[model samples]
Target: MKMTDDNKEIIFNNITKWLRDSNFVMSEEKITVVTSEFYAKAYLQSDHEYILEIMSATGIETRFALRIRLPVSEQQLENYENLEPKEKLIFDDKMNAVIFPQRQSINIKEKSAFLEKTISIDPKSIDAKQEVMQNISNLLGSAKKLEISFDELLSN
Candidate 1:
């Protein structure tokens, strides 16, 4: 679904406000304006920090990705284990963790009764990011529409 221009402007303004109030600090990498979109990066200030990438896709929605430095130390691994379950840690046997899209559902365990049960995320979380992307989409909405010239060329 595409958002209207007015809505896009509103969302962009709201996102900037939220980013400023967030606990994570926005670094130089945070603000990025590409040909068709913009991205925000938030860095955690810790011994082993992480980089959060927020992407507002061209004519789509905003999404987030998290990345940590390589060769995670033992202390960092332990700290990860301490995070609350509500945080939803995604780690393999090796203790590497990353967050997945709220809309995505995947089974973590095999041969379990819950295997068939779908894991879902809160609608609010998805909406927040989706709003960001929709804003970008709205900005490019007119350009995305097919031109009459294209149809005429096709007939020829």
Candidate 2:
């Protein structure tokens, strides 16, 4: 579905509602919104240090994504890269890898990485709210698990 202004508003409302109801304690002063011909985005930060970024794509991609950034050390990155597939960390086509619950994609960088989950958003669908909530939960869970794994790898 094309991301019209109405669709974008629906998505933004859903996200804000979810954040509020889920007790995320977002900083109202830190919230930001950006819109363009092709996409709409919201960046929100919580008191607990969780950064939630939501983007609705209107162009060819036509999707929605929820993302969070996590820190990683240089040694941890090297350890992750050396893991075998049996360890459940596999390289993507771009060769970036992360340990996870496996529902989200990780884009690793020098010191931090984004763990994101993308899904098709149909504002009019009956399941839209449930899908968005579930994806947000999954992204947070995956990030926590990855952080634990990184700490363990660093200790070893």
Candidate 3:
């Protein structure tokens, strides 16, 4: 959990390489990196957030969480006075990823509310350092698909 400079660089390099390989423009302006005792964070253009956290209990294992935050549809929002209650509240846009145990998510923001979908990973196999970097492309792909779907739905 202790984030050393070398550790931070390793994590940063992994993410940088992945973003570039995935055809995502990785410029100084779009990427933010931070490392602390408990976790390392990488933010991609403020749209994607990836974190590596060591749980309180080592037996519980370390986890990498990738969260893709996309804008909520015009209609679907975070708070409402009159609401439709259902087992699963599916958003009308790409933000409507209600698949549980996989894409666990939530909603909130201000200027434009967003739906944050998170995918958790176990990094024991991939070098712990490269875990988040390795999966970034997959994360972005899913996010891109969601964006496309949102656009499609909006058009219709």
Q: Work out the TM-score per prediction.
A: 0.36, 0.69, 0.46
Writing each residue's lDDT as its tens digit, candidate 3 over 18-38 gives: 655644554332222332222
- Name the candidate that leads on lDDT: 2
User: Candidates ranked by TM-score, best first?
Assistant: 2, 3, 1
Please identify model 2 stretches exceeding 4 Å from their true place.
Answer: 28-49, 58-62, 78-102
lDDT per model vs. reference: 0.35, 0.62, 0.41
Write model 1 residue lDDT over 38-124, tens digit each, in one string: 455554344213343444445533333222222333444344445466543332211121112222222223221010111111224
Q: For model 1, name the residue pairs that clash.
A: 30-41, 61-133, 62-133
Best of the candidates, TM-score = 2
Candidate 3 global TM-score: 0.46
lDDT of 1: 0.35
Report the number of backbone clashes for model 2.
Answer: 0
Query: Model 1, stretches more than 4 Å misplaced?
Result: 4-13, 29-34, 45-48, 61-156
